[model samples]
Target: MIVDSHCHLNYGSMTEDMDGVMQRAREAGVGTMLAINARLSEYDEVLAIANAHDNVWCTVGSHPHEAEKEPGITAEQLIELAKPEKVVGIGESGLDYFYEHAPRDLQKANFLAHIAASRETGLPLVVHARDADEDTAVIMKEEMDRGAYPAVIHCFTASRALAEACLDMGCYISISGIVTFKSATDLQETVKIIPRDRLLIETDAPYLAPVPKRGKPNEPSYVKYTAEFLSHLLDWDYDDLARTTTDNFFTLFSKTRRP
Candidate 1:
């Protein structure tokens, strides 16, 4: 079975017909999915989905885009909310220079707060770094110095140097549908070098849909295509790729209890 380690099932695109989307995921062999929270205000809805599904889990943190709005969100607040039975990760938070929707400094401060929560709670920080590779890497390294915390760069599309830096810090790398794109040759090259144990696959659904399913609203089922492409790219059997990534998800998000 495959696990979609990151997705936004609570988003409008998926929530409109979630039952159908989830049925399709099961049909496509996606046995588990983590419903990511990008806003603290929506944690209740995100957790509601997880509470109803045996295979679905959730996280509690704000995205970089919502950094300004959640400025008062402290490590203590995250730590408190994260005690929920369904919350397994600290964030989908980090720098996003591509959009810069929020001030860069605010984004960085919120990112650091999420990292602090991860350190306090022992949950993997679900990072979302965009074009600000240098600053992201530097901050991650600096934070590691304070106290090492488990983390993963979700939907990684940063430079090879940044990937190497994250790997050096023992951070996990999650591949999304972006890798299946023809123009992502650099990412493909980077994917080849990632250690199997430190690798993960996600759809980042309702956003980056893979080829053949491109331009359509993405869902957890599409993660299989990303996994299939990566399996071929890495020259490993599909089952092996699926098994290893699913195992890696469980290892990093150990707070999740499978039913």
Candidate 2:
């Protein structure tokens, strides 16, 4: 069985026909999913998506883009909010310089709060690092010095240096549907270097649909396409790849049940 390590089920597009979406995922052999909460105000909705389904779990934190608006949020607040049994992770956080939607300082502050939450609770941090690789790597390294915490660089398309930085810190790396694209040559090449045990796969659904299904609204089922391609790309059998990633997922997010 495979796991879609990250997704956004509470998002409107995917929620409109949630049952059908999940049905497709099961048919595609996806056994579990982690619904991501990018905004603190949306915690209940995101967690509800997980609570309502046996195969789903969730994270509690804010995205970098929303950082400025939530600058006052604290690690204590996040730690308390993450008290639920199914809240298996502490973020969708980190720096996003490409968009610059949120001020860098605010994003850094919010990221530290989530990192503190992860360090405190021992839950994995679901990070979203983009063009800010230097700072991302720097901050991650600095944070590790403060205290190590489990984390994964989700939807990774960053430089190899950043990838190495994450792995060096014992953090996992999650590849998304973006890897299936013809233009993601750099990412596909970067995928080759990720240690088998440190790798995870996700769809980041209703956003990045893999090829053959590219241009269509993404869903959990589409993760198989990315995984299938990755298996071939890495010269490993599909089952072996699935087992490795699934094992990595539960190991990283230890709070999840092995269904």
List the candidates' TM-scores in order. Answer: 0.98, 0.99
Instruction: Tell me which residue pairs clash in candidate 2.
Output: none
Task: Name the lDDT value of residue 165 in candidate 2.
Answer: 85
lDDT of 1 by residue, 98-179 (tens): 9879999899889989999999999999999989999999999999999999999999898899999999999999999999
Candidate 2: regions farther than 4 A off: none
- Per-candidate local distance difference test: 0.93, 0.93
Q: What is the Å distance of residue 35 in model 1 from its true position? A: 0.6
Task: Give residue 183's error in model 2 in angstroms.
Answer: 0.8
